[model samples]
Target: MDQAPLHVLAGALCDREGRVLLAERPAGKHLAGLWEFPGGKREPGETPLVALARELDEELGIALVEAAPLIRVPWRYHERALLLDAWCVTQWRGAPRSLEGQGLRWCLPMQADPATLAPADRAILQALRLPPHYLITPAEVLPAERDFWFERIGHAIEAGERMLQLRLPLWPRESVREFAASLLPLARAHAAQLLLNADIEGARVLGIGVHLTGAQLATLGERPLPLQQIVGASCHDAAQLAQALRLDVDFATLSPVAATASHPQAQPLGWSNFQELAEAAAMPVYALGGMVPAQLAQAQLAGAQGVAGIRGFWSAS
Candidate 1:
C-alpha cells in the first residue's frame, strides 16, 4: 500500500556567487546524514512561507525577509511521504550557521549531482538545471494561411527558442490539436519543447506539457497527473508562489519584473527585487513581463535561470 504523503517546508538559500546552501541531516533523524534543503515540517494552520521563515531562523540562524515563489515537489519516501514546499530566499541577515549542529555545504546547483542527493531532493536538483528563459508567442489568431504561422515558428525555432507556448485562445480544441500536430514536429525536429498553454487536453493528446494560468494555479491541490510531462504555472506573489511550490510543479513563471505594456498596472519588481526572489526560489525562475534577450545575462547574474519574453523574443532576427 502507498503511504500518505507528509507536508514539509524547504528552503534554497544562497550566497552572492550563485552557490546554494545545503544542510547535512544530523545523525539519528530520518534520512540523517543525507544532504537536503534546510527547512522543517509545516505547523498546523501555518503557511509555507511563514513555516520556511521560521525554519530558516531555527536551522540556519538567519532571518529570511522575502522568498521567491517556487514549485512544490511531492514524493513518497519509505515510511513517510513528503510534500516538499520550497522557495528561494535571497534577502537574509547574518551568515548561515548550522544551528542544529548538522553539517553544511555551499555548492553550485549542478555540482550537487543527483547521485549524492537524498531521493526526494534529487528531483529538486533536476529542476534546478533548467534554463530560466521562456518565449511566449502571442495568442491572437494565426493567419488564415496554414503555412504562415509555421514559417514564422520555424524562424523562432532557428533563433534558439527551445521552449514555446502555443496559445490561441479562441481556436477550437480540434483546431489547436491540428495546429500542434503540424507545428510540433517542426519543434521536435529542432530540439525544442512545445508547451500547450492552458490546453490540458491538447497537451496530453499531443504528449506535451501544459502551462497553467494564475487562476488555475490558485485552485490546484494534490496533483496526480502523469509524471512524464512537465507541469508549470504562472505566479504573482508570496501566496500564489507558496501554492505553486507546494504542488511540486516542474516550473513556473513570475512576471512584471519590470513594467510592460502587457500589464501596465502591475508594479514591476525590478532587478533588485528579482534578485531577492531568485535567491530563495527552489525552482529555476524566468523573468517575464518587459524582459528582453539582453537581460538574460543580467538575469543570470541576479540568480535567475533566464528571461522570458513575447515581443522581445519575437522582435527581430
Candidate 2:
C-alpha cells in the first residue's frame, strides 16, 4: 500500500431531529457522484475545523455555530494513506441547500438502506446503530478488588451506565477470565452490555463484545466476532476511523482531542479540529482523551455522541 499521507475532514450535519445530511461528490472530481460527508480537503496552514467551516459555508451557505470533535480514522485507501477526521455540526445559520449541485439526502439508519453509500463509508454507518452514550470500565489490577469494582459498577448501572468494558492490563489469564466471568453476571443482571478490550477470545468465552485497538482494526478478517453482540475499535485518524466504519464496528473511540499524560508529546487535535472530523463520519463517534462527564455538553455540541476516558469516567459512582 502507498504510504503517502492524505488529510481529509468530514462532518455529520444534524438537523432538529438529529438526522444527518450527506452530499454526493460533484462530477469530474475523484470519486465523482460518490456520497460523502459534506466537507473538503485541507490546505497547508489551515486547521481541519477551519477547512470544514469554510467548506460548509461555501457548499451549503450555512454559518456553523457549534461543531465538536468526533471520530478520527487513519487508514489506507486504494494504496494511498488517508487520515479522515469527522465532526458533528449541530448549530448553523441558513437552511442547507446543495449549492454545489450534488444531490443531498438525510440519513437515519433505521429507516435507510445502507447499500447506497460509497463502499468506503459503509463501515461507519454500521457502527452508528450503537447507543450514543458509552460507559468504559475502569482498568483495575487486583483480583481481590472484584467486589470493589462491582460495587461501583452496580451504582453506575443504576445511574444509566449501560455499557461496560474490562481493561486490566497484564493480569493473569485465569484471574482475568474469572473476573470477567464475575462481572458478566452483574452486567447482564442490569441489562447492560459488557465488552472486552482487545480480547476477542475472552469476549467469545465470556459471550460479549470486543473493542479492538487501532492497530488490530486494519487486520480484521471477515469479522470473526458474533453478529449479535457489539464490536468496537479505537481510532485516531480518518483512515483508521474509516476502516472501523467499513468493518461495521458497533461503536468506536477516538482520542487525544487534547494532550494527555498518556502520550504527553503526541500532537493533539483539540476540540475544534475534532468537530471537523466528527461531522464527516457516518458513525456515532465518541470523544475521548482527557475528557470527563462534565465536558459532555461541550463534547456533544461539538458532535460527539459522548465522552470516554480512564481517569475522567472511572469514578462515576
Candidate 3:
C-alpha cells in the first residue's frame, strides 16, 4: 500500500551576511533535537507560499516578504512520506524569534554540520550550496589549443562561473594532471571550485574532487571520498540517479534535456521529463546537454539546481 504524501513548506531564511536560519526540532516531534529548515505542514486550501508565511509567522514571529523556489524534496520515512517544498527567503521583516521554544541558529550553508541535521534536510542543504550555472569543459582540447581554452575558462571564471568540471578524456593522464595543476592557482584566486571528471585517482592525487561517469557511478557501492570532498555523477536515467543517490554523491548531472550537437540523434528528455526525474532525485541535479546559462531559470523551475553544459556554459558572456 502507498502512503499519502504529506505536503510541507519550509524556508531557508537568509540574513545579509548569507547565513541561513535553522531550527532544532523540539521534544515530542518525530525527529527531536535534529536541526531542520524552519516552516511547517501545509493546511488544506493553502498554497505552499501561504503555508510558509503562516508557519513562519506562527513559529518564529516573522513575516515572509520575498522568497523564491529552492527545491522540492520527496522523502519517505519509516512511518510517513513527505514532500518538502523549500523556498529561499531572500527578504523578510522582523527579527526571527523561536516563539515555540525551539533553538535557532544561523550559519553559512557550507558550514552546516550534517550530523545534527535531519536526514530529510540534507538534500536541501546540498541544494543551497550549489550555484545556478555548472560549466563542463569540452571533452577534447587539442594541445595546440590548450592555452586558448585555458584563457577561455579563465575568462568564464572571471565572469562569475563558480563551479567547473574539467572533462578532458582524450588528453593523456599526465597532461590532464599538469593542466589541472596549472589551473588550480587561477581557480583558487577566483574562488571557483574545480572538479575532475571520471578521474578518481587523479582527483585524489590533486586533492580535489571527482565527478563520476555513469559507469563509475554504477560500480561504486559507497561514496568514493569524504563528505567534505565534492562527489558528483553523470546520470542518464532514473536508475543512474538512484545509484548516485545511494552512493551519497554531493550532486549529479542529468543530460539531454534538449537535443545537442554532441548527440543530435539522441532524444532529449525535454523540460517535463527532466522535471519528473529531478523531483524524484534525492540530491541536487544539474540539467546537462544542450543547456545554456540562459535556461537556468527554466531548469530551476523544473526542479534542477542549475544548468550545465560544454558549449553553452563556456560560451556564455
Candidate 1 lDDT over residue span 100-203, tens digit each: 88999999875675545676775466455455558777766554645676788788887777777777776776877788788877787876777788877778
Task: Report the lDDT of model 1 for residue 203.
Answer: 85
The best candidate in terms of lDDT: 3
Which 10 consecutive residues of model 2 have the lowest summed lDDT? 120-129
Task: Report the candidate with higher TM-score, 1 versus 3.
Answer: 3
Q: Flag the better candidate by lDDT, 1 or 3.
A: 3
In candidate 1, what residue range of length 10 has the lowest lDDT sum? 222-231
Off by over 4 Å in 3: none
TM-score of each: 0.62, 0.60, 0.94
Name the regions of candidate 1 deviating beyond 4 angstroms: 1-129, 143-146
Model 2, range 1-317, lDDT digits (tens) per residue?
Answer: 54556777777787887588888878897778678778776878998889888889988898878887555555556777676676778888898898988889997743445556665454445444445457666555566677877787678777778776777775676676777777777677776777778888888887888889887988985565765667878888888877876777766688888888777987888888888777666566788888877888888788777787776677644
Kindly report which residue stretches of model 2 are placed more than 4 angstroms away from their true locations once superposed: 1-132
lDDT (CA) for every model shown?
Answer: 0.74, 0.73, 0.88
Candidate order by decreasing lDDT: 3, 1, 2
Which one is best on TM-score? 3
